[model samples]
Target: MERTESNGPVTVPALPSLEPIRLVDRHGRRTAEPVVPSPDHDTLMALLRGMVIGRRFDRQASALARQGGLAVYPSSYGQEACQVAGALALAEQDWLFPTYRDSVALLTRGVDPIEVLTLLRGDWHSGYDPRPHRCAPQCTPLASNASHAVGLTYAARRKGEETAALVLMGDGATSEGDAHEAYNFAAVWNAPVVFLVQNNGWAISVPVEKQTRAPTLAHKAVGYGMPGYHVDGNDAAAVYAVVSRALAEARSGGGPVLIEARTYRLDPHTNSDAPQRYRRDAEVAYWRDRDPVSRLEALLRAEGAAGDADLARFADEAERVAADVRKRLAEADDPDPEDLFAHVYASIPPSLAHQRADLRDELREG
Candidate 1:
């Protein structure tokens, strides 16, 4: 440890070094040897298809928000590789704890596009049932969902269930107390959980440089006594391989693992945020050129795993899904005024009752 020059706290460099794992390059060429057997042609084709759909979904969601359909939306624009791969890594019995920006992951996990966007549209508390889908509500309050993921996995362990929980969070969430607590708890209890942190180079408008002085976010797992994996988030094959191994280990009784995926957010943090406020046009253009969808498409064409027909089919499918998303969102019913008072208290308090009645009367008058 070194002492500070003044009253400010001193800092020490204690974490181990990190090198990100990558299986593919920007040209979609293999960059590293695989530990497990290479994914079959079908798997690669599916991943490519999912990435295309996710990209289209992100674009459509952003357009809907601008058209006054959704109250807000967080696009996974350039990070679709991480989202699709992580979602596909899970088993059917596993649970997913997703953040507001992980709608792509949710859709890949078999969630309805409309149901997943309901909360973002400000129509309902949660649009899907957690019990059936094994997915928690999409979280918005930073790392709060991390704690909930830990709790759910811990409960499953107590019940003697062989299952794991995969949590998807942003780099900004690592700064929160709930994320730290969840990491410590999961590591200590040896809970079956995989934490996938999509370190997309920015926490809202803040850059990774401003977020920490550590070599990388993966080092954050070392202090919690869990193995940390650094992966190129833009490489879908790498993200899938890393997450799949981690989840398999967790369910087999190994402790949790934390994966920090390095990627870039091509779009603004949300519809309300402006990328030009803190990021450059060149930087965004740079990432757009490295877009996951295009990369995977290139690889498939080169490998002969997908032909022109396959590419066109995937593109058409993506457009159809996007159209459906728009139609369903536009046709969804309006929320009832009484819903504001729901799920808050077992019995309504006098103040809430009065407020509910006032809202109902206003609605009636309108």
Candidate 2:
């Protein structure tokens, strides 16, 4: 046993396997371990299609922000595998709690592309209802959604439901209080939830080095008495494999899990950010080469799973998705500025009613 001597005592170091689990290498070749056989060829093709669409959607959203169609946008350019895997691993009855950067995840969950962007388009709230889709709003605050997820899972279990919840957050969220609180609650209560942390290198401009000194985010799970998975975020198949297994265990009353997907943030944190100030071109180039979409495409070609025409159809569908998003956004009815006043309270107070009436009068006069 390896031991480190402290001034007061000697402590044995843990030799847990910290290497990230990867199904595909950087060159898109399969790993030595046997592949998880559940997701067949058609599933692989579907994953590829979702990833391509996500990439296209990310690009379109960023372009929209640049062109002033959106107020702000977070581009999940290189983290599509993590997003798609988290979304797809859930059953129809399961819930998803996502962050603002998780719009791509919502899209993978069959959310309308335009509906997912409505909040970014400067709407007062997320345009879609949460109950119907079993998704929480795209939260902007760090790690707040994690707490919400735990609460939802707890409530579901109290009702004897077999449902589980998947919580998605970036590496930065791990450092927040809400994250630890949620993790503690989930572990102690044995809540049926999967916490998927997309370790995308940087949280805004703060690199992971400045975030924590932990061996890996997944190691945090050991402290809480739950299994943690360290996986290659760029490997779509790997993410799907690990997340699906975790979700199954959670649904079966196994305690919660923490999954840290090792990935990179290929673009700026948001449209308003200047990533060049904090990171170098060479670093970005390194991650760009290990792109998820490229890796999956290479895998597809290697396996002869999707030929030219099949690939072409997926591409065409991706383009249609992009076009439809643009059109829906262009044709979207402008939000009524006064609609903000209506949503704040179930029953309007007299003072607020007076204020609303005054605003209505002013708008009518103008």
Candidate 3:
């Protein structure tokens, strides 16, 4: 853990910290692993690739939104490690409830890349089916997904299914009343679910300092009779280990775990907002310098696990994937307006039925 010899605010290195596991320091140094061994070359490399691909995809989505190809996109640039690590920790049969900013997690859970893009393009219902993929649609209404996750887990328990339901949301979500209610349900029933809050320090420019006065987001779990763990969201290995342990506890009927992954959002909340309106230039530069991709790359290079050629290949693959997304998105159709009314109920009510008929008539006449 090297220190920056400056009078400025000292940045904490990733190593020798128990609370927040940092296998790779921000300066591209590895922290000593006395008890747990470091992840092998292949595993670490795969995690790095996932983060790279996710960051590239997020950037591409933002660009597409700007180019009028996407309706809106919530970029998940800096939070890739948290998303990928948490989702990858789960078993294939486990359920996932993700937010709009959780593309990295969904992708890690074996979701088809193009299918997610189509959902963002407003071309489908349920994104990809949850029945087969074990991953739910991207829940947009903040902490509402927490309730759904608890319900799903309860159903699974009733069915004697050996699975856990993991739900992802932002720190801003914790302030919602729905989140609290969902926590209550999970604690009372001892449902197999893990509530993962990616504390990215800002909710569309509303900094975490203003979001809540809680000492730590993880501490909130104690009120719900669940244990909480805080992990470094920028460190993929740490994120994986923490989330994986939580998943195991949940699967073994130890109730829910609330994991607050401390990280920073390296981009604006969306393509439309200017982050500069609220945050400082120095803060942005500080986090950008500690790029998650670079940290992993340095570790890989030092271990002789990756060479220049490997890095180049990774960049090339990211570019190819981004290009294909754009090409396919251009040709994708906009979602049908009527499709929205179709999924809300088992059968349409009389009022909505009449409205649908009127909508159809208007479309035909137009």
lDDT tens per residue, model 3, 52-153: 888888888888889988777888888888887777778878998999888878877878777776667777755687777788889888899999999999
lDDT of 2 by residue, 9-61 (tens): 43332423578888888897888874453366677777888898888899999
lDDT of 3 at 118: 65
Worst 10 residues of 2 by lDDT: 7-16
Model 3 TM-score on a 0 to 1 scale: 0.87
Q: Considering lDDT, which of the candidate structures 2 and 3 is the better prediction for this target?
A: 2
Backbone steric clashes in candidate 1, count: 0
Which candidate wins on lDDT? 2
Order of quality (lDDT):
2, 1, 3
lDDT of 2: 0.87
Q: Taking the tens digit of each residue's C-alpha lDDT, what string does model 1 give over 1-366? A: 544766675333235336678777788787666544456678778898899988898899999999999999998888999999998889989999999999999999889999989999998888898777788999999988888888888998899998899999999999888998999999878899899999988898888888788788889887787788888788888888889999999999887889999898887888999889788899888888777777877887888888989989988999999999988777777887688899999999999999998998998899
Candidate 1 overall Cα lDDT vs. reference? 0.87
